[model samples]
Target chain A: MSTFRADLHIHSCLSPCGELSASPRAIARSARERGLHLIALTDHNSARNAPAFAAACRSEGLAAVFGIEITTREEVHALTLFPTVKTALEAGDEAYERLESEPFDPGFFGDQVWVDENEEIEGMLDKLCILCATDLSLDDLGPWCRSRGGILIPAHIDRPAFGVLGQLGFLPEGPFEAVECTEPLSEDLTDPWPVIASSDAHRPEDIGCRCLEFEAPEADFEALVMALESGKTRALYGNK
Target chain B: MTIKELQTDMNCRAVWNGWEDREVTGAYTSDLLSDVMARSEEGQVLITIQAHKNTVAVAVLKDLSGIITASNRPVPDDMIETARDEEIPVFVTDNNQYETGWRLHELGGF
Candidate 1:
């Protein structure tokens, strides 16, 4: 039983499928309410919101891991987490270019908005131009994440779509430091693999409903990541 | 063994000889673009059956050392051309996706 509480797979509004209320502040407040000591914001192929998300979490005295949920060429989903928002954002720049179509125009995604720590709509990202085009590959993005002192984890390996197992039939060794299971392991998963579980929540209400508890030296983001990379954690469920 | 050795062991011809220069970290087999984009690291070999322009795009994005088109399937000419341009090795194997994945695991010690 670890003392630290972590929800490393929460999504922000940047994800097309996530709730509009999935703002950074809302996620931070929800994490606090859920008694989470640490959390990560892994928007789909974008880390644009990670800075604001990290700021919000800091205000609430909660540790945050800057991250993105990248979609690979194999159509597998991977969680790319960073030690800081700057690192996450840099990686996001490369990812945005690869995942997005070319000759980008910000005016295209008029529905996209940027918010501050207070969740106040500040303005549209002028770099909407940046989000418009991409050529990066799945294999390329993993190294970019790792280069920035980040960790890459295959997301929801047990699921059918966008899962490592479902798509590739096996784990491809690359930049991944760990693998995440969205649900409980149906079979005994031990040895030769380090596995963790999270809710992969798209809503604030979903935060910490399922979490990973890491025993670390402190509740800082780096420490927690180190703990996770070291395979020193356990999965906990709220409603189960 | 290195990717070069693995390629030879698998009886695979190197489509991009430069791949011989890169170190083989591990083997990852997948067809899902999103998951691969999220997890693949640099210098690792990618194995899959799906062949398309997006497959090349994903490989470039992930910085994979090379790509193996499994199941005895031939890679599309367009993809091969693209691989040449990107300097990513593209190969076709007689083994199916599963068998190739297992064999690589057994041989590569990944």
Candidate 2:
């Protein structure tokens, strides 16, 4: 088989942690220019920008995964990749509803813009997206995402903050067959799930910088999910 | 008024080469990124003393015309890099928060 480059963790401007130039169009263009085969627009706790990002990716001929980097109540982060954009939105609605009631003050944080496929300013959400965490604890978070047909990849497992290893003291036993890290090939893990590395890029240009080269029959969502689920550790190549 | 006019009118300096001809339709002042996200409209100039990398993040999310680091807080290079990468203008002033607020109010003609 052949390996394709994939960075399944990207944040659009929908993420307050992501830069504004991180518009869906800009991200797709940059990813295409950088020779990435596929990417995921995994905003922080919200999939508000995925529809637009998916459309933008379509124009660039890049496969975009509709996903979110969800932070559980315990502060552990998981990258939830959905098989379809609608599924992600459905799960996001439920996740948003579960977030603690914390009103946003536009005078302090700034606006949350939702752009359209044409890069038009569609609307804005007043919620402070990055601060709210889902009510699910670490254990609940995994199954919750899976119930929605999402592939749960614990994000940045090597980091001291927001990482499964650091926050939960250990990676919980779950349906996860693969894991995502900020860097490549971390040997410190007590249990090795086949690792996939991503840039975790909040900025547009950083997309695809720390991606994984994996054997996939095709570059679409199904092929990606199957390849990752198989988690052939020997076939994974990460550019740390 | 354009960001250049806003800077010259308010006596500010370009901290990074983030100057753009984008017009400042209005102004917003805040310390928290979430507050800015929840309230501030697009194309407004954001005023804050919180100088860190995330400042640029808010600027991008909100489509801010520019950022002003009031109270003379030092803007870090990484934050400036984000601004530059995002093409958002960042200006700095030696005045404290109140003085900066008053000047923006005077210029805003409100």
Candidate 3:
């Protein structure tokens, strides 16, 4: 069995709040240098950066997953992962349609830029208001994303704002594979589903600082998803 | 008072003239989205200077009568689009929040 060092929640420059230096090339190089076995590119609300991110990961010989951190209409945040970049991007497009009716204003809340592997601007996603929650609810999110073949996990359950339990006061017990915590686990916290921790890093230094470790035959997307769903590897919350 | 009546009297300009017949029985004023979301009631006129797109979201979520960009402050271009799309009347006026509140008090029961 191989022990995989995985940081499955990370943002690229596509996120308006993300550091400009968190480009696809810079992330991949940093992941390799930090000895991360797997890194997932999870930009907020849109996965348009997956193509460039996956390409950079391949060049570095590091495993990568395509994912998005979506904020539902009720202001709850969730992380959705897809096995393929094509599927992830398509799902992102669908989610963008349901986002809050306001469009992104670079002058107001800053830029929501789409960049390539070399960190060149392709275009800006003007239709999406990246800062506020999208116009989707937890009930609407499960049926829509699962039909497109993606796994949803309530993100940062410890926080008071967008965390599922913090916002809704109870987990919906939907098609979620797990719940992610950015803070340390508390025996006081209880949920029917498993909990995992990630850096949810917006900067290169925070990447792999907190991650999930597991033993699998191979550290591929399929294996990681199975491991999470089957409850094989719970979490390895290493404080780096 | 109705949105059309208020706008006509205030000499407010329409950025996107939504259901003007919508009644204004109450009014809310705040810069924070969550504050508006939590405190504002339906059919109330929201009198904030906040000119972002999320302002439109809060208006819809809270079922406001209309949005007035106070002091003739420019609302974001997309915000007007959302107000129009949601059929929520959006207006702009030279009056600040104090003047608007005083006007609403004269109208009474707001």
Winner by DockQ: 1
Q: What lDDT tens digits, residue by residue, belong to model 1 across residues A1-240?
A: 347988889877666556778899988998998888988888766788877897898898998888878776666778888888888888876776666432223222333455777777764433322112245555776677777888888889877656777776776656467778876775444234567778788789888878888888788777776786777888776533
Docking class of 1: incorrect
lDDT of 1 by residue, B16-81 (tens): 566445677887787655456556787788888776555776667667877888877666677777
Per-residue lDDT value at A217 in model 2: 75
Q: Is the docking of candidate 3 incorrect, acceptable, medium or high quality?
A: incorrect
DockQ of 1: 0.08
lDDT of 2 by residue, B1-110 (tens): 77888888999988777465877888888764555655789888888886776678667766789889987888888888878877888888998777877888788663
User: Across the candidates, what are chain A's individual TM-scores?
Assistant: 0.85, 0.91, 0.92
User: Which candidate number maximizes TM-score?
Assistant: 3
True contacts kept of each: 0.15, 0.04, 0.00
lDDT of 3 at A145: 73
Better of 1 and 3 by lDDT: 3
CA shift of A175, model 1, Å: 5.4
Position A18, candidate 1: lDDT: 66
lDDT of 3 by residue, B34-106 (tens): 5566567888988978776778766775678888879888877788887887788888888998998888777
